[model samples]
Target: MSKENKHITVFEHESLRTDRGEQRLTNGQLEALQLFYGENGVPYYSLIHHGVRFNEYVGVIQVGKTVIEVLPKADKSNDADRWRNVLINMLHAVGIFDIHAPSNSNLRLRSNSILDLYFELFIKEVEYLLHRGLVKKYRKTEGNRTALKGSIQFAKHISQNLVHQERFYVRHTTYDKEHDIHAILYKALKLLSYINTNVQLNSRLGALLLDFPELYDIKITEALFDKIALDRKTEPYRNALEIAKLILLNYHPDVNRGTNNVLALMFDMNVLWEQFVYVSLRRHKANATSIAAQNTKNFWKPLSGYRSKMKPDIVLNKDTEDCVVLDTKWKNLNGYNPSPEDLRQMFVYMKYYGAKKVALVYPGSENRNQSGQYYDHSSQDSKHLSNEECSVISIGVEKDVKAWQKIIHENISNWCQLQEIV
Candidate 1:
């Protein structure tokens, strides 16, 4: 397939119409998407009657030869290419991609999709690892050998080696490059070789596969990645291993058809926005202030079973007390009123966390700051307002990520300082 024909770009909440030319997906591709949605709970897209409507998640999804790049769009005027760059910058800010600097020349390439960037980065990591020499670890092995090495299994040795007296069944530990980490990298490389459509990355990927050791395939799972422990010697492989884990875990191969494997490399924009805000604040926070992400507090308890907890996206603490609680929303307000549920939730967070100020943070075209106060039930006068304040702060997105982050930190710091005045 030609690159132009195979690549499709759509924004969040947009539909992939089946009748649209150059944007319609094949039946095989739809089937692959259906399977992926069915298996992955909290799907990124919903199946329409004749199309697929993507939600607030953005990233690349590759089905067979077709690559669908979903970009985040909070503004009506933003295009796919612009939001694509924003998404890439956001990912880099959150440390998802380890690139030192992404140039305009790189982002301007129409031929490169997010998947291509991912493949190229993975290939580079593997190339560096091969240059430094693959790390070897001691792994336990059990098999039949001609010469006796470690302690022999008596039952297996007696049964299997009865006919062949020279053969021995023994369990031994061998120090070699054939370990779980290498196994994972090898698996990711093999997957890339099969699904990658980039012509430029193919030769480099081929060289990586040749240099990378062929290890036995193991079942890829969350637990497998959790079990990995890196020391000083293997620390350099951290970036490569992180990417490998992402690729191996997200890939779902078709068992019945074998051709329409689905690889969904996606991120929830809401979550990403929250993280980006938290990272920005943490990086530029005052010496006395500390920032935490996803702080949970006990909200409700049933007579039996697990208790419910309220987890706010970001919390800022000055010295010891909670200074401000900020909940990040990815949607553009556009002068619309905040949702009632969101206001009530922030109120609960304020009362429970003892935060003097609470804010709902959003992304918008221009910087907006709105402030309000909660009604005090204890006051005899119904019109009396409490000292606790709730504000809506929107930080505008800038062309440069550093400038955008600076705006975020500045706005948030100002919000925190306001609490000190009262």
Candidate 2:
């Protein structure tokens, strides 16, 4: 496969080379990156620099026909499994996966194939849904003699041949285990079955195949999922449906499409990082104020009315006033100072929100081993408000949820001072 056709970036793996080394990004590729910059709630990206060195994220980003390859951070193993767990928890906190759904945090998928991991999560979820029994609906049934299961339509039967069989329109609610959901699952499974390249993928597919019935591989689309509905009785299927939806949505055939053409899938780490913090804070806040992500509000407006609105990442509201506005940056800001643009943006947030405190949070650099610091910028921003304070807080990414949860809780509580509860 041509380098342009297949761009590879794995978390912690050494960056791969294309025919041309470090080629300039195409206009389309830049546009794709921008689209990830915000359009969707999830932007999978970090800045190009971690400290002073270059550190791009991993994944294949597609814009037009061009593919942008980003390698993940080098660490002990790709730890893709662990990252997925992080993503799952993040998603759970963000309200994507069901809170009650079983998590695979304990199960680490031992494969480098992104497709394999995705397929594994998806198929397993489908099995769970199927095991719970596929949802059933009542539809009009005609023809077939002997069961007399539903109400017979005598009028239409009289128009047809003499009655040896009952011509009926009936409602049957039973788990037939055949539906569009299964059709989509079957189609995805069929795609997985043809792969011979990855042993893990092929083996996993083989194992899954035994469990799934021989269903026709039908053409599946997002609309297929839209057509199905889950009621209170089949509420358990929502989690599985979510998993299946992701798989089918991103499933693209790696057809080795000529040298220049490509098939790619990627996520913006920016969105992921923002959501991680916002949701975590919302989940475990010491204050009772409202926590909002990307709240829409204007900061500066001209007399002619060319509105310049500011969108802060996270805001904490008390009563009717904005108490704290926090902006999350996915950078290792252990020793570095905040950029002019960043400080300015936070200034706008504090000024507009009338917030007493604002924070610029970053991930602590791994090698630095430096403890997080608090720089009181209250005096610095006195021009805006003498009492206003801006702090730079860094928190380590803990492997344990409870530990991480505590870390997040303590860090937030440390920054906030709430009034006594009446």
Model 1 residue 377 distance off true place after TM-score fit, in angstroms = 3.7
Off by over 4 Å in 1: 1-5, 39-41, 99-111, 142-144, 152-158, 161-170, 318-322, 379-388, 418-422
User: Looking at model 1, which ten-residue stretch has the lowest summed lDDT?
Assistant: 100-109
Superposed Cα deviation of residue 72, candidate 2 (Å): 4.8
Tens-place lDDT per residue, model 2, 1-422, is: 54333333344223222223344444334334433443453334432321111233445444333444444332344565565555455544655434233564222456344444454566566656556666654444355344656555666555563655444433344455566656666766765465323445566578767777677666667777787777796677665566556655654443333222222345455666688787677666645557789987866778895898778888777325537888887666547788878877787777788886788877663322222223445656533444445677777666676567567656765666544211
User: What are the lDDT figures for the candidates, one per model?
Assistant: 0.82, 0.55
Locate the minimum summed-lDDT window of 10 residues in model 2: 46-55
* Model 1 / residue 127 / CA error / Å: 1.6
lDDT (10s digit) by residue, model 1, range 298-373? 8899999999999999888832465678999999988987898998999998888888789999999888789988
Per-residue error for 171 in candidate 2, Å, reads 14
What is the RMSD, in Å, between candidate 1 and the native fold over all Cα?
A: 3.5
Which candidate number would show the highest lDDT if scored against the true structure? 1
Stretches > 4 Å off in candidate 2: 1-15, 19-108, 111-116, 139-175, 195-204, 216-218, 254-265, 287-289, 298-309, 319-322, 366-387, 419-422
TM-score of each: 0.89, 0.64
